[model samples]
Target: MAEWLNILLRSIGLFILVLLFARLMGKRQTSRMTFFDLITVIVIGVLTAAISLNLVNVLANGLIALAVWVFAPIGMYYLSIKSKMIRDIVQGRETVLVNHGKVLEDKLMEVRYTPEDLLSQLRKKNVFNFADVEFAIMEPSGEVSVLLKKDKQPITAKTLGVSVGHESVPQTVILDGVMMDEPLTAMGLNRQWLHTELEKIGVAPENVFIAQVDSAGQLYVDLFNDAIITPKPKTKDLLYVTLKKCQADCELYALGTKKKNAKKIYQESALELTEILDELEPLLKK
Candidate 1:
C-alpha cells in the first residue's frame, strides 16, 4: 500500500512538472520537437518513474525534482530571450533553401535536408516544380516558406489592369439552409431582404448553397446543386453603356470628365455587375 501510494504521488507530481514546463515553452516549440528537446523530456520521464518507485525520498525528492523540472525551462527561456547567441543555438536559425530561383546544394547538406524533402514541402504550399519558386526558406521549426516566381505568381483581375474595387471577406448570412440571425443583424440585413435577393437571382430560398454579404452591401448567392453553374456575365463595354444612359439622364457625365461624378457612375456600374453575378452564381452550384 505504501509503495502504491509512492507511485501514485510521483506520477501526479511528474505530470504537474511536465505541464508547467510545456506552458513555459512557446506554442511553436511544443508543436515542433527537436532531438535535444525529446531526449531531455525522456530523461525527465525516467527520473519521474525512478522517484515514483521510492528510489529517492518520496516527499522531499519528488518535490525537488518537480521544482527543477518545472523552473529549468523558465530559466532557459529568460536566457534565450536575453542572449541572441543562445537563442539561435536553442531555436535554430532560418535556412535559405533557394536563393533567387536557384537551389543551394551546400546549404541543403548543411541543414541535413534533401532536395526531395524540400520539394515535398513546396508541394504542400501548391508549388510542384522548382522553376516555380523564387525563394524558399526552411524555418527552424521544420516548416517551409515559399515565394513564387514572377510568372508563376497568381495574378488577380486587379493585377491584370482590370478595374476592380476593394475586396473583403464576406459575412455569411445563411449556412446549411438555416438562417444566421446574428450575422444578418450584424450586416444590417434580414431574412426578408435575403429572400427577395434570392428571388431576383431565380434561386429558391431552399436551393441556396451559401449566401454572403459584403461590406459594400452586395449579395453573393451560390446554389446547392452542382448541375447549374453558369458563367457570370461580362460586359464588353461598361463605360460606353453607362455613359450613354448617364448622358441621357444627366448630360454632365463622361468616363474621365468629372472625378466625383465618375466615381458615382463607377459605383452604379459595380452594383449592376454584382447583381448580375448573383444571377449567374446559382448555375455553378457544383
Candidate 2:
C-alpha cells in the first residue's frame, strides 16, 4: 500500500513538471519540428519514463534528469534563433530538386532522395508531368513546394485586364443549429438579421448544422440532415457559371454549323461570349 502511494504521488508530480516544461518549450507543432527538436522530445520522454519507474531516490534523480533534458533544448533553441549559422547547422537548409524544368541530379544524391521519391512528391502537388514544373524545392520539414511553368499556369482576371473586389475571410454565424452570438456580434450582425437571412433560404436557425457569412455578405447554410447545402447567390459565381455554359454552347454550335449563315451566327455568338468572359474573369480570380 505504501509503495503504491509513493508511485501515485511521484506520477502526479512528474506529470505536472512535464506539462510545465512543454508549455515553456513554446508552441512548435510536431509537423514543423526539426531533426534536433524531435531528438530532444524523444530523449526527454525516455528520461521521464525511466525516472518515473525507478524506485530508489526516484524524486530527486528524476527532477534533475528532466530539467537537464528540457533546459538543454530550450537553450539550444534560443542560441539557434540568435545566430543564422547556428540555425542552419541545427536545421538544414531547403534543397532544390528541380530548377527550370531540369532535375538537379547531384542535389538529389546529396539529399539521398531517389528519383521515385521525387516523382511521388511531385505527384502529390498535382504535377504529374515533369515538363510542367519550373521549380521544385524540398523543404527541411520534408514537404515539397512546387512551381509550374508560366504558360501552364491557370489564367487569372489580371491577365484579362479586369478589376476584382477584395475577399474577406468567412465568419461562422451558427454551429449545430445553435446561434453563435459572439461571432454574429463580431460580424456586426444581430439575431433579427440572422433570422431574416435564414427565412430568405427557408431554413430556420434550429435546422442549420453550420452557417457562414462571407465577405460579400453571402450566407452559406448546411442543414442538420445535410439534405441541403444552399449558398446565397453572389454576382461573381453567377457570371462564372454563365461564362462556362456559353463556352460549352459555343463548342456545340461550332460542331453543328453546316451552312454559311449558321457559321456566321456561331462566330457572332463566340465573340459575344468572349466579351462576357472578360467581364466574368475578375470575379472568378477572387
Candidate 3:
C-alpha cells in the first residue's frame, strides 16, 4: 500500500513539473517541433517515467536531467538567433527540391527522397503538375513550400490594374449574444449604432451568435438560428431591391411632374435600372 501511495505522489509531482517546464519552453517548440525538439521530448518522457516508477531512486538526478533537457534547447534557440551558422546547423537549412520547373536529381538523392515522395508533397500543396511549380522547397520542419509559376497563379485586383482600397482584419464586436464593449468602443461605435445595424439586418442583440465590423464599417451579424433562417440580404436580393426603388422613383417623377423635360429624367433613371437588372441576371442564374 505504501509503495502504491509513493508511486501516486511521485507521478503527480512529475506531471506538474513536466507541465511547468513545457509552458516555459514556449508554443513554437510544440507547434513547429524540429528533429532536435522531438529528441528532447522523448528523453524528458523517459526520464520522468523512470523517476516516477522508482527505477531511478534518486529524485535529484531525474530533476537535474529534466532541467538540462529543458534549458539546453532554450539556450541553443537564443544562440541560434544570434549566430546564422549555429541556426543552419541546429534548424537545418531549407533544401530546394525543384527550381524553375526542373527537379534537382542530385539534391533529391542527397535528401534520401524519391521522386514519388516529391510528387506526394507537391500534391499536398495543391500542385499536381510539376510543370506549374516555379520553386519547391522542403522547409526545416518537413513542410513543402511551393511557389507556382507566375502565369499559373490566381489573378488579383493589382494584376488587372484595379484599385481594391485598403483592407484590415474584421473586429469582433459581439460573440455568443454578448456585446464586446471594448472592441465596439475601439471601433468608435456605440451600442445605439450596433442596435441600429442589427435592426437593419433584422437581428436582435440577444439572438446574435457572433457579429463583426469590417474596416468599411459594415456590420456582419450571424444569429443563433442562422441555419434555419438567414436575416441578411443576399447580393442578388439587394440588387433587386435597388432596382425596385429606382422604378418607384421613376414612376413618382413621371406622375408628379408637369415640366416638359420630366420624361427625359425618368428615361435616364430607367436606363440605369436596366443596367442593374442586367448585372443581377447572371447572379440569379447561379
The number of the candidate with the highest lDDT is: 3
| lDDT per model vs. reference | 0.71, 0.82, 0.84
lDDT, candidate 1, residue 237?
37
Report the poorest 10 consecutive residues by lDDT, candidate 3: 277-286
Clashing pairs in 2: none
RMSD of each: 8.3, 9.1, 5.8
Model 2 lDDT per residue over 1-286, tens place: 5877767776787789889999998887355887778888898888777766664364677678789888877887789899988878877789999999999999899989999999999999988998999999988777889999999887986877668877778889999889988888878888898998888778899888888887766678888776676755464586678777887787678778888788777778888888878765755646
TM-score for candidate 1, please give it. Answer: 0.55
lDDT tens string, model 3, 44-145?
999999989988878898789889999998899899999999999788889999999999999899788999999999999888899999999988887889
Weakest lDDT window of 10 consecutive positions for candidate 2: 50-59
lDDT of 3 at 173: 92
Give the candidates in order of lDDT, highest first: 3, 2, 1
* Total backbone collisions for each predicted model: 5, 0, 0
lDDT of 2 at 196: 89
- TM-scores for every candidate against the unseen true structure: 0.55, 0.75, 0.79
Model 2 stretches with alpha carbons more than 4 Å out = 55-57, 228-286
The reply for model 1, stretches above 4 Å from the true place, is 13-17, 32-59, 161-286
